[model samples]
Target: MSARSGPRRPAGLGATTRAGLKPAIFVTLVSVLAVVVAAIASAPFRSSTNVESLLFQMAPLLLVAAGQATVILIAGIDLSVGSMMSLATVLAASGSAFGNSAVAVVAVVLLVGAIGGLANGLGVLSGVNPLVMTLATMAVFRGVALLVLGQPGGSVPSGLLTPLTNVYGHVPLPFVVALVAIVLLWFATAETRWGRSLYATGADERHAASAGLPVRRTILTAYLVAGLFAALGGLALVARIYSGDPLVGDPFALDSITAALIGGIAVTGGRGSVLAVVPAVLLLSLTDNLLNLFGVFSYWQYVAKGVILIVTLWGYHAAGSPSGLLAMARSGWRARDARAARGTKA
Candidate 1:
């Protein structure tokens, strides 16, 4: 009977299975697997304390990733986030000299970050490429932070820092804050019309503009949100370290971008969620913790991280499926056609 019709599989099951294999889900699964492997390999070093420390270490990076993901979502990049964070920390510390007033510290830090983001947004909207604009701002902001706090030394009051740094009955406050931020971001990106417009703009800016979308304003707002989050992250850093160093966020800009990429946030944009970044940050933090436990040198760890970054990025590009499965299907069809032709010729 029609050659048994290939065993007569159910019609919708294949589609459902494919839907379950989304890129975000795949990346998350890989991240979980990596964590399990890390835990096993570093068994001797594993403990509740180490887990807590890993969560603590992931806080700043997660915050930065949360912001950076927004920028990348809009098909833009903010190379200045790290510098902005550093500048904010310095500003907050110096402003703390105003009698440890939390409001004053928060305001100063946010203002600095906002100014930096404004600069980035203006440049980008005015036709300057995001990369160049943010790079220039990175230098400017870092210079300003150095000028403000040359030696990288300022004390944050324990009263202001302790609540943020301490674990509340076995739960890290920063981690909890990060989780809240992720939930908020996920809601913003998924349940809001503005979020859909952001994706539309990133996916096809010309089309979005033609459709009367406020492309410029949307992009500007995205940068502003990123700036605000970076400022918050700077505040968290100050709390954790109990001091505001001028160079506190020197590596975060790159690391955050790396984390975002690893978390399935497509660099080309319009293809990911903020929720995806959590696992990425966790994976990186776990790897670092395991390395430290094994007494691996910092230099070697850096090399390993770089290698992982390259490999993960390659994997993302290879299987992103952003353009749909048509390309893959076409390749398969062409292969089949070639085989058929060979068979006929033979």
Candidate 2:
């Protein structure tokens, strides 16, 4: 008697994956259109320097979004990701305090992230709401980050950061890292058994458990993965700035969630595609780059992001759900059938 043989197994999981891909595909097409339009309309936006800048900007956000999406897939959220990122940067920059060994700092940062994630998971298992538990950890992690660095003043070895900036024909190392993260995560969520289990657990926890899935472990793993990715994002940020800032990651918590949602991840969980996040990140990074090229005030970029987020959310919901493209298609078919029936009667 395997979990797959359980009465809970149905056609929904396969449909869910396909449904999620619809929004991802839509976002990808839109992202491509945006790139083309921006390049055609603005010379600077298409320049080599700006292209590099956009890629650099997209790298860290993509990493963080990957982690955020993992948590979201399991019907959970990790608000502390931003704080975890902030903590990672400070820890990495504090290598001087830890015998100036980069490896030790990196190891410590990852460890802290794992511990933080595990704590969140354990709290959730103890009946704490995921939102409440992560919110509390968010404050705690930020506090620890501040206490460690107090401000943006620690340095990373230039030697280590240089390779991250190396560009081969305009493809920076950071962007390559982001691409790798995307591929690996896409594989995990799409091909692995654990990945399928994640969707199951998220879709219906009680049924997933009855089907013999390790519901508790799945939840824990999701948070742990998120923490590690946030840490990786923080490391990427360090490569960008060559220093640590306790406040730098403050925007990431919301931004990652925005990207995930915009990319087609349902807020309710178990109903989105990780692959969709790439275009969502690209669109966001492009919007910022284009805004700068057009000389828009920095504050207005926030307004623009908010507007885009609202429009996408409204559009997705109106269609049906986060996984609404499939639903929209089905509705279209039914409507066509109705129209044909009416015509025949006439």
Candidate 3:
């Protein structure tokens, strides 16, 4: 035998391949689950009308979650995303009410968001912990939003509203926008060299830098991209509510984080897919729908929602358990099978 096999495979190669496959499989299982849940919820839940409405409502969350996933991919988080969106709402409203026009409002939100993200990246590069830096920015943005709109009321330009909430060829504009985001993000993360660099950096920053990657630039790019998405999410929120509310984005930070996690984006970073988020968003939406249909008390909704997240994630986080998602999915599918069994007996 040769002293060394022709070329010993790099140990990380198997791991890298596994890392890529894990998210895809996890997403596939979760998607299958969301469908079954819809079927059980009600007949209308599976209808085209409901699909359109669901897509409309989910559009903004998709935007926000898409960004949140990217941030987490690089072992970073942006707590201020919700505040960035809140700022968008107020800015959009004030601009419309003040006659600043649709294009002006969009421009301001996207621009400011990018600036804020730039600041976050700079802060982290200067050696501040990313969490602390982003948390501080979150406070600043929320304070600014409150200063702009102390109350839960303001106008969204009629011109902006028409296209966002309106339909085109049986598809709402928001749905189309969300689709574009997914496609763009998918291409960026899956096809580009910078995207590969991001995964490499997240997997091991030291190693990535040593491999000739521009680690700092990649991190900054992720933040900037996240900011753009947050701005877009804010625009979607404006369409949905048609007004500005200081607290409009309060739920986004948590919801987007949860959605990203459920979608197979790891909290530790370096592994996930925006494509997975499609099904995860639907699953969360379906859960909310079922809660409403079952007449769950308003106050209890939080408890129920928390329970769902916990149970689902508990199996997911179980260490070395051969994929927590597979376990949760198996249980979920078995439940579906049981439901079918009862139907057969009936």
Candidate 4:
């Protein structure tokens, strides 16, 4: 009411931003706590060697998850990314055919990824469901990778692998690449007009289209970006393993999605922050690392990841979407009251 009071900020936008940010804050705290506990419990976890390895393990997932998060933001998913990564590794290992040059391999892989993404986008536009379209591509890409190299014997030039895995002091180069990508993507999703369009379109495609937000273009571009990121993940994988395995990327499709969900990216699409993906990825990588260090069976690792994902989903269902939770609770209460009335009559 003061005469000198400045124009009030938009309350709705402020509330939305805060709502979107809450999960990220919770996840960040959880990640930090997990790190601290792990370090205290296992001296080896605090070692520089293990720290470097953890970063190395996280890089590929970080790349793939960022892209996954992008597509997810637009209410679309790219199941083919793991296969795309597989294809990239095989191509990179097909020495001499690509002039034995790392650059050539990278270029071709990126092109393939973009083309694959374009195909997915076009398919979705043409009435194909995103899940089915990407799933089909997943099979195709993996088959192509196998055709390129039936076995995992092809050699990647040390030139490509060496620099990718190199550490500057305690930081792995691949982690740096992942971190830069996360930062850039965070900026784009949080700051840019395109990012706003992405959130709008994902929140409601029909409404976004009516608002003239270029919904189609945003969807197509999102898929293309996902493809490019998956290719980058493939390249990172090459550095980690120093060899191409047709099945090397098999786990990534699920892993990337899991990371995105765990990072607070809404399953329904339009909510959440990309910045949270960093800690989400770290949490996953750290869990796996600690499990291995503690001599847990590989099968148990899968069980642990599944449990974590389920818990995250439940938390979001219960806390993130208040309306849905309230509706469910109200329905349940009405049903209970009806049953009580029937019992009284009896």
The model with the greatest lDDT is 2
Order by lDDT, highest first: 2, 4, 3, 1
| Candidate 4 C-alpha lDDT tens digits along 83-108 | 99998888888856887787887788
Location of the lowest summed lDDT over 10 successive residues in candidate 4: 1-10
Residue-wise C-alpha lDDT for candidate 1, range 90-159, written one tens digit per residue:
8777755767876767777777777778888899999999999999988998899899889777766556
TM-score of each model, paired residue for residue: 0.82, 0.87, 0.81, 0.86
Model 2 misses residue 134 by how many Å? 1.0
lDDT of 2: 0.79
- C-alpha RMSD between model 2 and the true structure: 6.9
Models ranked on TM-score = 2, 4, 1, 3
**lDDT of each residue in 139-217, candidate 3, tens digit only:** 9989999999998887787777777788775577877898789778966876677776776665456556766778899
Task: Name model 1 segments beyond 4 Å from true.
Answer: 1-21, 40-44, 317-346
Off by over 4 Å in 3: 1-29, 40-52, 96-99, 298-304, 307-346
Q: Model 3 TM-score?
A: 0.81
**Native-referenced Cα lDDT, model 4:** 0.78
Candidates in order have lDDT scores of 0.71, 0.79, 0.72, 0.78
